[model samples]
Target: MSQAPASFSAVTPYRPSDAGRSLMVNDKHRQILDGLREISQESSSRGYHAKAVTSAVDGLRGCAFPVNSYLKDGNPNRRCIVYPDFEIEFEVGSYYGGPQTDVSIVDIRIFRSETKTNTRAALWNVTHTENESGSEWKRSRDPESQLKPTPKCSGTENDSIKIGINGFCKNIDHAISMLPSHITRGNETSLGKLKSSGYQLFYIPQSNSYFRAGWSFVRDLGRTSPSDLKSSQILASHMREAHENGLFIEWTSHRGGSKPLTQAMKLLAKQGVNVAGKQKVFLSDHTSSHFEADRARRAIGMNTTDSKWHNSTKGIAQLVGGQIFGGASLACSINELINHTKREELGGKIAVIGSTAIGGGIAINSTYEKIGKLIAEHGVSPALALSVLSVIGKTAIVGVAAASIPSLNENYHNGPQDPIKNLGNKIGKKLIPQG
Candidate 1:
């Protein structure tokens, strides 16, 4: 050892500055990184090109580049790292100077194949960043590119290939064949693998198709011991598949127990799954739900429809139809709320209370649900105003129930039908269009 130390040759140390601090890459980014490495190896100067990518990604750890620098009209929180060979796009909540930044890799792309300069930086379209309209290189404006388009979940063409199976898919191969061709190849493959395991494939009906709830399979934990092998396997498979496909998995339980859902999602995150935010997940129309409808009505001090009406076909039309009267009512009400809220004059002594719960709008009793919700949503300002009036002990706050209005209340109390029926018509005119 002493003799070797005496005659040691001077050589450059093989240590990368970001040896311990590397840019975090998601599943999609990881794939792109692997592909880029393969391409770099074929280049004339492999080491130089490969090292450039490493340096570019490592530099992103402490960079605070503007989102606009990548996506022209995207959220400011979205940012990207551009290198000669490729660009790595990511989203972070906020910017701070540190070795580690809270970020999620959204996409990674090499230069366009048609382009002459593979080792040059160039501007890219923000729309292309999401690959919403297909890959960044493809310029087709086909709406199918918009994968999760809600009302038009089947895309612009309503011609979705309907399938009916006589028997359950027994294996992963059968499940793949049964699935609609509309699903991406990667997803179909992963789903096949999942089904190939003991996991069952739950086919959703056409009505609930818009919800786009991914395969709802049950894992029987009763069969397993404390190890819970089956449950663990299913959860791991789903998390891996979802992350690989850049899908956001939102687990829910209708059984009044969130423990299973919470545990599964926690495990997914622990396994490095790209668990997307709630807002990113799309569900059925909010206005269609009675709870949402009631909330909206209370927010604007207007009873658009009764709870019964909100659950029927009338409620759905308000959200679906573009040229229908029900649709007009929703648009008008929302517009009114938006415009009114901007007004400086928010103080008023007159409060109109409406209730369809008792005798439509004819009952003497006010709808507490409506009033309570309104007060709660308006925040402290209204309560403070009422407090000031109470302190004065002179100003009167007139709370007039909608039923107290002579026009809506008089005959309604005597009539068997709801007073709110047919927009206060003596004869019940269809307030909602049947067609």
Candidate 2:
């Protein structure tokens, strides 16, 4: 045995040639290598979902997704990410020779409809659609045609119908019955499964839906506290159902002051938050400092009623009635969202990217320094950039700031996470957008 060893022992997974080794090799490098391999192996395969997988992978070369691990609604040990759609594994390359490259991959998560799927076919299609929309990608080569054994989660590929439920459309029986006549073959689904069955799926409800019925009172220049109208019943109903169904509740509280975090942790702990906790829960909106409001306004965006274009009649009319405002001074559509997404990807800054504590945004890009400054001035994402959004905030609020001026976002994009270092203040006038 010691003579030459078995052939398998000599085989390394995959390695880059001498020229590919130059940088400090690490796990991230290995993962990128693995990802490359995964993509390469599938390069010549053409299935219903094959093209879709490749398309979704286009924008990833530069924007690598991270392996997100977090506590579920209650189970700390059980977790999953809401963004990644697939895991691309590979070994690292281009530095320190090929031997040091470890095996790794990028974990991707994709969420339900929105600010946001299933079997191999579903997953492939879901990712494919997403990739087609991104403007940051360059297309790859074509492939061969073949069928794959639908890979199962932990070795269970039942080829059953997978229904990804969005929000809490609880009337499962009705939803299935309502499917189009063409596909409803004697209760036969996407798969041959029958017996009127479907798995339940859920997402965190609109965080502040209950808080809005009496908005006339709560929206008093942000004077009202969340504790004023809450009940254990209401809170429990919203947060507990998903838990019962083994579904996770997305925490949607916006970060501002320290109080919000404290209350959120409590609520997440299965405890409820009332409306009057004032400093105990919701933080101040318009703070005493100018920077606080400035940053918040930047993150929270302009109120739907606020004018986006210049005050001039023509500009306001154009902006309000234009794509930015959804043709009516009040609405903004998915098309606008798609445009902004492209802008953000191109390294453009949004005047404001407003969100409630739990409201959604593109992604997390802030560091402790940017967080501290904003919090010291006015608190937000430094800790929690999520919150239960008010109806108006959810429907009408579009984050708008003074437009890209000398701010942390621009600073971070151009500099490093720890930018306060020797980078010096390259901050420019592009911080906030000015009308």
As a whole number from 0 to 100, the lDDT of residue 231 in candidate 1 is 29
- Model 1, 197-258: lDDT tens digits are 21112111121121122111122222322222222222333333434444332221111011
* Count of clashing pairs, candidate 1: 0
lDDT of each: 0.29, 0.24
1-435: candidate 2 lDDT, tens digit per residue:
112113222323233342322222235444654564466555453233334334434322323322222234454323232222232322223222333322222333322222121111111111011245652211112211111112231111233222121111122222222221112221335323322222211122223332242122223334424432121122233223323333322121111111222222334343232222111111111112233332332331212222321111111112222323232211142223234343212111111122211123222333223322343222123222122112112322342221111122111121111112111112111221122
lDDT for 270 (candidate 2): 31
Q: Which sections of candidate 1 miss by over 4 Å? A: 1-22, 38-51, 63-74, 82-85, 94-99, 117-435
Per-candidate TM equals 0.20, 0.20
Cα RMSD for candidates in order: 23.1, 25.8
